[model samples]
Target: MPYQVLARKWRPQTLQDMVGQEPIRRILSNALEQHRIHHAYLFTGTRGVGKTTLARILAKCLNCETGITATPCGTCSTCQAIDAGKFLDLFEIDAASRTKVEDTRELLENVPYPPVQGRYKIYLIDEVHMLSNHSFNALLKTLEEPPQHVKFLLATTEPKRLPITILSRCLQFHLKPIPLELISDHLHYICKQEQVTADKTALNYLSKAANGSLRDAMSLLDQAIAYGQGSIKSDDIHAMLGTIAQQNLFPLMKALAAQDSNQVFHAIHLLAEHTPDFSNVLEELISLFHQIAVSQVITYQQKTDQQITELAALFKPEDVQLYYQIALLGRRDLAYTPSPQQGFEMTMLRMLALQPKQMVVQVETPTLTVAESPSWQEILPKLDLSGMAYALAANCTLEKIEDHKVILQLSANHQPMLNTKLKDRLRESLSNYFKQAMQLDIIITAAELYTPAKKQEQEQVERLTDATKAATQHPKIKQLIEMYDATIEVSLL
Candidate 1:
């Protein structure tokens, strides 16, 4: 016999075998027992989450020889035929493959008739959202008012694309991704069944990579089994998945935490030789920072006398936030840069540069100065526009200005789509620079969209931003960010 792949071999043969979808199972099983069946059912979920599989199981339950029983005896001819995909009453349609008005009409043509063998004719349409708008409308009528003998099972990753009228007519159940622990248990079970030897550490990595997909995790495990040739190792899994092991990531972190750029750069060059994924490195680094943050909090809760004192000295919250931002922006820019090494070096340098400059170690903590919130004057300069454009942006109705103090009234309604937090942040930035006092009051009220007189003006703004970005390399500008930091975002408006 030919060897079957894990995904196919481990496919849930019955509803009881399916994992991570207890609510749907209970509902469907009870519906079968009570005979309270709906004419149309919709199953929606991400890929590898068993939406289609559940649909198939439901079809079997509906058309079994034992007469609509939830648990169909596999020995029965009706259940056997359905399992083999040869059941006359069951028609599985890939809406993606046959997505046309004519195809939908043709399929529905047989729907009006009674089932040839079973009690009901089941139409399972997978990826139903892929159907064209016209095909969806064509099927909507039948699904909304189908013949009593017919049942429609529509499965899709995206249900929003389907018209509300179509959605309202069906009973929708969303299948969730299987949990990691569940996938891990299933993999161990499958390995035992297949007589395959595996390591727990290898399985843990595979579990995370699967991202809550049983089929994907099983497939990975299957590949590992073949690669291991009867033995599984975490090292093999790491190489297969392009992951840098914890040992590799930890040293890189020490270099970063110590702000040792020379060692960090050397390590990066070594990493580049192996073509280490800078994106993943950045991700792992951020995760480590988060771990450190948690550790810092845990250190604080120590009822011991030295605990709270030590926690206060843990990596300052401000510095942790800075490194996170640096790593995040580094990851985003890594995609556009010429090479990963350059992006890696730049991110490290950014953190080092942000280290607080020496301040003569004042004997007493500096008096806390009350800095006013940001105001329009301070913000206009950062807008990256000049002359006329800058003036127009600053004039954002300079409602009031007195001796370095200013009140700029915004057309609150002008850009209703502007994020509320973003608007307030920008407002505070402007107020801080515009005043020597406490804060510049920002009152946002609905305003209308500003109709630019010339379309070219908006075009010029976009062109200017592109030109500015081209002139300023991300890392170079990143160099200027430090303890008190704010990122510049260019808006087309």
Candidate 2:
């Protein structure tokens, strides 16, 4: 006969044959057994997650000669006809193509009629969201109240675009994305059945490349098998996908973790030859970091001989989190740049920039000795924002008493629960060696916590108003006003 792809050839023939959708299958099975049949149903989920497949299977379950059942015998004539796409009663529609109101009106007009030839008539509309508004309106009444023999199975990846009126009428069943582990196992099954020798690692890579889509994975595996001839390997799969070799990323990650600037730059340069998508490289690092993180959490007994053992030893969990943050920022900056390569380089630099500052600044300043006073003069001007924040917590404000510790007013608001979680995190995150501790004393002042309108900037603007008013009347200003017939929209000092 004709050449058959693995996805179609190994398609699930029964509920038992289906993979990675236990919840949906279990629900449908129970519904069938209990005879809790709904007139019309909507199946929603991402592409290649068995939405269409389930619709087809459900069609067989409804019309099989064995009677209405979830586990329809695939050997039966009705089941075979449905499986081979030759069933007259099971009318499969790609709403994406037949989305006009006239088409919907014409087709749905038959919903009132009983099944023709088969026990039940099944209408499977794939990409149901693509139906036009008018078409959906035409379908609404029929779908809500179809004849006893008619079953409408609507499927769409984008369910949000579907109107509530249509959605409300149908019994919705969401077909979820298959898991990665399940996809990998499915690929292995396909390979063995195809009589192809393939490395398990290659299948794992294909599973990931599929991104939770079984149809995509099978299509990819078909191409990989053809490319590998009699045997399939990870290297061949990687090349076929235009994916960068894992080692190309491994050394780069190693250098970044080591804070080896030279080696990191060299690795970035080498990536140019492969023409690797820089964003993909960052994503690879994230995945690697995730692996290392889970590895660190593994107990002694759980440390079986695995490939990630070395990675667990090489990086700390905290370092993994840090690198992930840097890589995330780099990826976010990709769109704003003029050149993708420069964006790529900037990402590298950003990842490297997390290395702790090495420079030490030494400054000498004269000290001032102040006489003892009943109350200290608060020197708020020289205090940095962080320092000011600390002083605000203490009852008394700190004075710049020649860089020595000054007092700040403290209140009950500084108590743990009263203080916001954000402030506590900021307090805990100080340089480990030696950061100034803010001290508190009770000072009666009318000052409130800094507000935007009360910020030093706005305060300065308020002060400059008088000066600006004075300058507005200058003789030179008058002369300029007359010369250009100009009024000062803004007067600059």
Which numbered prediction scores highest in TM-score against the true structure? 2
Model 2, 1-493: lDDT tens per residue? 9989888887887787888889889999999988898988888888888888888888988888888899998888888889889998988999999989999988887777777679888889989999999998888878766777888899999989999999898889887778999999988888888799999988888999899899999899889988999689987877777666566677777777788889988888887677766667767766777777877886766744365667567776766776666667667877888866788777678667644332222222223333323332323322232453444432233333323233333333433322444344333332111255432323334555332213434545654564445445666666545533445543323
Instruction: Estimate the Cα RMSD of every predicted model relative to the unseen true structure.
Output: 16.6, 15.0
* Cα lDDT tens digits for candidate 1, 1-493: 9998888877786789898899999999999999999999999988888998889888889888888877877778888898889999999999989988899889888888889989899999999988888888889888878889999999999998888888999999998888888888878788888888888877887887898887789889888998888778887877777666555665566676677888777777766655657776677677666666666667455453343233335457667777877788888788887877678788888887776443221122223333333444454666455444443354354456565444545465434434555545554555565444433433444553222212235556656566446434555444544423645444432
Per-residue lDDT of 292 in model 1: 60
Best by lDDT: 1
Off by over 4 Å in 2: 245-248, 269-275, 297-301, 304-309, 312-318, 335-342, 356-493
Worst 10 residues of 2 by lDDT: 357-366
On a 0 to 1 TM-score scale, where does candidate 1 land against the true structure? 0.69
The true-versus-predicted C-alpha distance at residue 210 of model 1, in Å, is: 1.4
RMSD in Å for model 2: 15.0
Model 2: lDDT to the true structure:
0.72
Off by over 4 Å in 1: 269-275, 298-314, 356-493
What are the Cα lDDT values of the candidates? 0.73, 0.72
